[model samples]
Target: MIMPRKGGKEAHDEMHKANPNLKVIFMSGYTADAIHESFGLIARVPFLSKPFGPSSLARKVREVLDTQ
Candidate 1:
């Protein structure tokens, strides 16, 4: 997961360029729509909003892992 303060999309793009098969689960305080709109991440990438509990985090992680 990447938590870039700025240039988040660029960072993600670079990572993907380096390793296209890398699985990423973006976590942010912003809503998923906001992140998607801002980053142009229209792809079905997994996302987790901030302020989540341990179980929530765990569940999201598992979901991402399972899909990959």
Candidate 2:
């Protein structure tokens, strides 16, 4: 998982370029909608917002893991 700022997306892209099968889950303080609206990247990766509860985090991780 990564934060989409300060070259985060660049690094993620580089990793994906090296390994197309890489599964990424982006975490941000911003809401998913905000991230999508601002960066137009919701279609590219799974995301989890900050201040989430353990259950939410676990569920998201499980969802990503299952998909990948």
Candidate 3:
């Protein structure tokens, strides 16, 4: 579980500080737009909305990996 005081982005930031090449696919049960606005994430950032199936998960992973 993530710390209540620190969200995923904060945790990712800390991790990224250690390894700048880290790639992430943020996930949330909230709607993608809501998550993006609330989290201050860019539209093109890799994200996976909840309740996704295997194929969708695979596709998202591939998309993130394929991105520069």
Candidate 4:
């Protein structure tokens, strides 16, 4: 579940309740402080910032999934 840091807090919170076990990769170019303030701490996973290289992102995805 990849959700934007945009939209209101309600949208972000709703997603977790729907599927708490879902693996989410909250991608945001904004700083970590901004994301935490808006969405609260995600125990599932951290976020991916913008401008990340393709291979790095792919590797991350694979690593996350591989753990499952």
| Clashes by residue pair, model 3 | none
Per-structure clash totals for the candidates: 0, 0, 0, 0
Model 3 regions more than 4 Å off: 1-5
Off by over 4 Å in 2: 1-5
As a TM-score, model 1 comes out at 0.81
| Residue range 1-68, candidate 1, lDDT tens digits | 34546477778789999998887878899999988988889759888898889999889888887885
lDDT of each: 0.83, 0.78, 0.83, 0.66
- Can you tell me which runs of candidate 1 are displaced by over 4 Å? 1-6
Per-residue CA lDDT of model 2 for 1-68, tens digit only, reads 34456455777779989999988878888888877777667565888888889999889888988984
What are the clashing pairs of model 2?
none
lDDT of 2: 0.78
Q: Write the per-residue lDDT of candidate 3 for residues 16-67, one digit (tens) a residue.
A: 8999888888888888798788878789878888889999999999998887
Off by over 4 Å in 4: 1-9
lDDT-better candidate, 2 vs 4: 2
Candidate 4: the clashing residue pairs are: none
Candidate 1 lDDT score at position 34: 89
Error of 2 at 36 (Å): 1.9
Instruction: Write the candidate numbers in order of decreasing TM-score.
Output: 3, 1, 2, 4
Q: Could you tell me the TM-score of candidate 4?
A: 0.60
